[model samples]
Target: MRALRTGPLLAATVATIGVFLSLTGCSVAGDDRPVVMVSTNILGDVVGELVGDEAEVVTLMKPNADPHSFEISAQEGARLRSADLVVSNGLRLEEGLQQHLDAASAENVPSFVAGDAIEVLDYSEGDAAGNPDSHFWTDPARMIAVVDALEPVLAGLDGADSTVISERTADYRAQLETLDDEMSTAFAAIPDERRALVTNHHVFGYLADRFDFAVVGAVIPGGTTLAAPSASDLSDLVDAVDSSGVRTIFAESSSPDRLVQALASEADISVDVVQLYTESLSDADGGAPDYLTMMRVNAERIATGLST
Candidate 1:
């Protein structure tokens, strides 16, 4: 097995890649076909659907990994700097990778921020209020918008077949529309009063906005999972949950549910804590292995948890 390179060696290699390419009059990617590196698996899946076999899609985040804190290997970091195009979920979502993405951009790599393609939402309450919500995939309509935006970006890549990209994007947009409709119909069955959400963190803002649900509270009281809940924070959230009469508190599949379970117990009310595929996609054989499946599974789970 090849040992991983790190420290100054990796940084120097990444830094000199551009100079090496310029000296050799060769592409930095070193691949004949276009290579696109995505900061997260969700965007990777969408990019894969559009590019198909046209480009080599490299995803940094693994399935079920926390996007906010996940980091790529030094070798992957070097590869990222050389990618023909780099895609990331901006708005400070990839907290651990901001520096790497910025480095890629500094080198003039064709970088795309998927969050920029959609209508971003701000947290209306809690510690996360006024901050941009990076979890826009919860709204399939926004994802459709992303697909429309990404189609043009992918088409612009050299060696990418514009016709193939366009056709695949259209098909994927239709699927997103269908998912939006299904989610709407499913969420409609929940009583307005019952459509209150309490989760591990402020992750369901977009879903709540799109489905007419209210984000009652969150155990962590922030947008990113990195935030911890103080005793007062948990107490406040518990009070909010009890006052809202929310019977279920949702936890993220990528995160531990102990805090959510503790919140349920602290609430002094009969509340159930359930897990949802909120932050990341699952591996194959898991319930949510892709964007569409993740949203569908989350919708069904949310509706079931909220209704009863």
Candidate 2:
């Protein structure tokens, strides 16, 4: 497991080496509506939908980037501090960017943390057990909670149109409700015995909890992708995979599947590897371009992978 950085060290790192945003840009101080800087693409999509044209939503993470380790450019870091509002997944999901977020808070930029809006799931087992799982978007109900939490936050933003925000929030919430039902229906088709998951990392705890699947184990031992599995870790997971009898091991679009593939080779039984949009949204050309589409596409892929 990776050594957990102390909060002070993280803050010092942020002060010294901030999340590097690659894009060049001056701060948007002249916009009529508040400029909201969101840390990840997933939150960017959902918040963009709710706020619509009410605010300029500048998302820091690029499409399909790993949220756990992606950094912002110094210019982007400046924008993060200067923005009217900053939004982050929180609960330390933004592993590399926590310092910059802390700096933003220190600078007094009003911010919203999506993690605070819903029930948090901790790793049920492994070295990182009892640590909050930051991938709560897997469960649409939690996202609904995020939407509920974000509405008032958006309403409070400078120059926010409360009525438009309210109307759009309602529309998006309905869409999420529809998505939750769809995911539940899709997962219901998989047998109870087949509902076990092995993945790149411990990213699907909320999804497993939401839909009644068991997280057999992860390729990495912890909640963050930065942690690599040891030989013993891989050996233990291979044993679990063999006993669990799951046909497929899921990999995230953002993370490398090489570890998962290596694990498959070591398993006593043959197990296929399937890719899912576990952590980040993909580009527009990819399958999961937005939050709703992401969940729907992931559900279909998971159901097919488990049922077959």
CA-lDDT, candidates in order: 0.88, 0.90
Model 2 clash tally, residue pairs: 6
Assess candidate 2 and give its TM-score to the true structure: 0.89
lDDT of 2 by residue, 1-308 (tens): 23455776778777665433312122333457889999999999999999999999999999999999999999999889999999999988998899999999999999999998898877787788888888899899999999999999998887989999999999999999999999999999999999998899998888888999899999998988899889999999988988888889999999999999999888867789989998999999998999998888889989999999
Against the hidden true structure, what lDDT does model 2 obtain? 0.90
Q: Residue 244 of model 1: what lDDT?
A: 87
Mark the regions of model 2 whose C-alpha exceeds 4 Å error after superposition: 1-30
Specify the poorest-scoring 10-residue window by lDDT in model 1. 1-10
Worst lDDT run of 10 residues, candidate 2, spans 19-28
- Please give the RMSD of candidate 2 to the true structure: 13.7
**Model 2 residue 91 distance off true place after TM-score fit, in angstroms:** 0.8
Instruction: Give the C-alpha miss distance for residue 131 in model 1, angstroms.
Output: 1.6
